[model samples]
Target: MKDSEADSRSHKPCVPFGRIAVLGAGSWGTALASILARNGHDVRLWARRPALAEAINKTGMNGDYLADVPLPESLTATASIAEALADVDAVLMVTPSSTLRAMCEAIKPHLPDAAPIALACKGVERGTGYLLSEVVTDALPGHPVGCVSGPTFAREAALDHPTAATVAFPFSYEDRLNPEKSPAARLAMSLSGGGFRPYVSDDLVGVEVGGAVKNVIAIACGMMSGAGFAENTRAALITRGIDEMKLLAQALGGKRETVTGLSGAGDLTLTCSSTTSRNMSLGFQLGQGTARAACFEGRPVVVEGEVNSVSVTELAARVGVSMPICETVNAVLHDGADLRAAFTALWARPIEAEPYALELSLAHPSPNLPLQFGDT
Candidate 1:
């Protein structure tokens, strides 16, 4: 196909974006890199360990994550942050939530002043209780940051299965100084691979909170499955899960509509129904005869819901949103409450109205204008 024809086919308004960096070598990062490379962008997958980078370069695969999934030849793996970020237009960060702050700090000196970042992590920070975007903006102030979230599983996405996600910009992406360049628009184009649909949203909080909290609810569902409960039990957990997710999102200044969109309801459904979910799997083992220590002893992947249970519960409490399911999960996980006892406590709570009521106010948007990023 002609270059112009290819560009048109790819749905991008402009020419190719040079050297896009994915700042993590985990399953999600590797998968995203493969998609971007197939779209004809120069893509780099960053690994902290040099051996992992070398392995990917030599084997044409990421055995640790993708398990023999063939990677695109156009994708390159690198250990050097400078090598990945230098001359890059945009970056997608799939790092663990705990490491996001540190990773951004390390990438800051090498990052272009106006480079937009799209974070794929799905957990809030521990202790301080910051969302992924809050962590990003705090570390890289003045930079444009967005989030990619929904029901996407990295393995499915890598296999080119049909998948969809939300691309959220908390701040405006179009430059006030130069109206022609919108980094979010360009980044969305670069991320849309075959069978992967990217929908745009301005509800960053709703998108992110949905992504972060669904895993917690999924764990509760897993316990139901593992304990030999029927589908009615699972359905109830999912129903209550959405209610809490919406309440938490709105309490944090996000809209109700965004909470009900792809990132919220879609992701919750996917996570709750499948044992493929890391958090659900972990919860399954817990609900069965296995101990928590035994369940996670040799697990290689991060069970984000395990972490989010604590953070989300805390965030809701501080913000005055009631989430009994999340609180029950937290108690079971951390406070050593017996699984049966935890369930009983939740079951015995005083019943309220069908939906919760709360006074929610959105944060005043940042006064910063869009920063120039991609080629004009």
Candidate 2:
């Protein structure tokens, strides 16, 4: 609620799109669908399961992910991928990282050419180590792609809590939602309202990296907290976590300052500090002496950091970017490294007088301007 249209997007004419297709009926998708519908957009939620779609349509709530949160009455759902995509002006891809490629493929044949899409998934490809945009661009080439990421939790968003995100595109708040408006502008206008704000940026890679790395760091924070480590330890992890994230982003050719913007700094602050985070919760359980199998046994939830730890470490290694915190998280998650040992190893590294000092550009420290994504 803090980010009014005037507060985030610069003055630009905009018009609302009529029909929006939201792929993925999970908590995040449903929450966003409700937000858009509440703003008077005709929105359809695409569910993989027919029963889930029927349940949402009948009860106006997602039985699996969001039991108590009420959804907008006009919000609809369908199991047919083509039906969901038919005549829709925009697409909101909200599936998890594991299913992103499949979801993209499923929707590809149904999507109109040059249709605008905004992805909600985070993390690198499990084996390919490609960003979500990269994967999507390969699947839906020539369709203008963008993304939104920040400190938004599905439950909080459903509760109408204030949530702001970083988005990319050539459109602006000044762009009237005309038929000719850019995909970024239409997607932003479609999702804006009800305490949800979007801060536009062209650094989609930076935003994606920020979302991916923070989950890994949040796991470390949870481990430290569960093990009864002091706040100082958690602070150290978060501080170093951002430093490594910035390094990785820069190595990938993203602007250096993207690491400090909404996706990077804001998202890290939210994920690393929250005890309720899925990744943090898993780490806390591990730190509390629970076995990995016990922690995830029978749980259907997806932990972005669990996989991102591997992908990010591999990415950093390939580019020779030293990501000690990320590497340590991957170790604890996969290599059975002791949590305390990883922390100790991190501390043992030679201390630098100014670790974060770099030749960062002063032109734009944040994506508050109208820079277009994929336009470097």
Candidate 3:
């Protein structure tokens, strides 16, 4: 269906929920809160600083993060978690991955048991290597948990540009029986409106993995761009990056097709090709000979790829997945490997057939077959 038609159909004047607490007043969080408010929901946005909350409440704008877009009057800001969660029907956790656990712990006491939690953040937990969905489930057990992700930039989304995303929530037996009444369906409905379309799925792991791994891949693409590589090189990285994403997703028990879906291929293309992405921009700086410290010295926003590179590489090793691109990014960013040298090494690696072709060859060996790297 056309996006405009979908937007009109999905937002046919349904009664909005009672209240939604959007924890985290960053660009992404504020944008999402604005969408909910625009959809006629009462959205309470939580900011870390009381001053920022006061400013947003007074001016109806998140000047620090989203200076250009004016937030809806229905969307209010607060610094107190208790006030935000007081009578909330749902919660959207949009904080950084590294601090998600602490945020969940802080909200547990105030959160309603019946309220579902939807994660808008990307990336796995830093030390535990847990996907954001897993982290939420672990910290806030008994609450229905899901995630919303796709190729979306906060500014565009806040401005009401056409946007679509995957809203994934693993259904329980009961949820499957009453699909319409399920948390997944409700969350999808609540989040869809104002030129924003959300497609539903049951692949929670696939969604989270795609969202996390794509950031790492975007950094690699940015590095190639910074190093003066052409479109051909960037194309190659994106193609191979999908393979890496699929391998890791499957190793972690997610569907391979999910890696090729909106949260994966769609997101990868947008982030890797755009400097608006924090991860890609950070990689570009590194590629231009800027020190990691210098790149991040005065930056207010967190560059998720720099942080996820370490956890993603570790997770790949633990799952025995071969993600050379992600590993190289981790090496360059965290281990201080020389950027040009790393790219040189990557290019110097032995040539191999595409993954599917190699699989086919493995299933049917022949004397005339080209020798592969591991062939005896």
Indicate which candidate wins on lDDT: 3
Question: Which lDDT tens digits does candidate 3 get at residues 235-314?
Answer: 99999999998988998989999989999999999999988998889888877777777875556668888889999989
Q: Count the backbone clashes (under 3 Å) in each candidate.
A: 0, 12, 0
Per-candidate TM-scores read 0.88, 0.88, 0.90
Residue-wise C-alpha lDDT for candidate 1, range 179-230, written one tens digit per residue: 2245645666677869888887778899999998899999998876776675
Candidate 2 lDDT over 1-376, as tens digits, reads 5657558865657676789899999888988888889889999899999999999999988989899998889999999999999998888899988889998888888998777888887888877889888899988898878787888888898878889887764344553344336666567777788788877676777888888899999998887777767578788888888898888888887876988988888888888777668888888777776888778665666888998899889988888998888888899889989776676666666545554555332332333332221212
**Residue pairs with backbone atoms closer than 3 Å in model 1 (clashes):** none
| Span of ten consecutive residues with least summed lDDT in model 2 | 367-376
By summed lDDT, which 10 consecutive residues of candidate 1 come out lowest? 367-376
Candidates sorted by lDDT, descending order?
3, 1, 2
Error of 1 at 240 (Å): 1.0
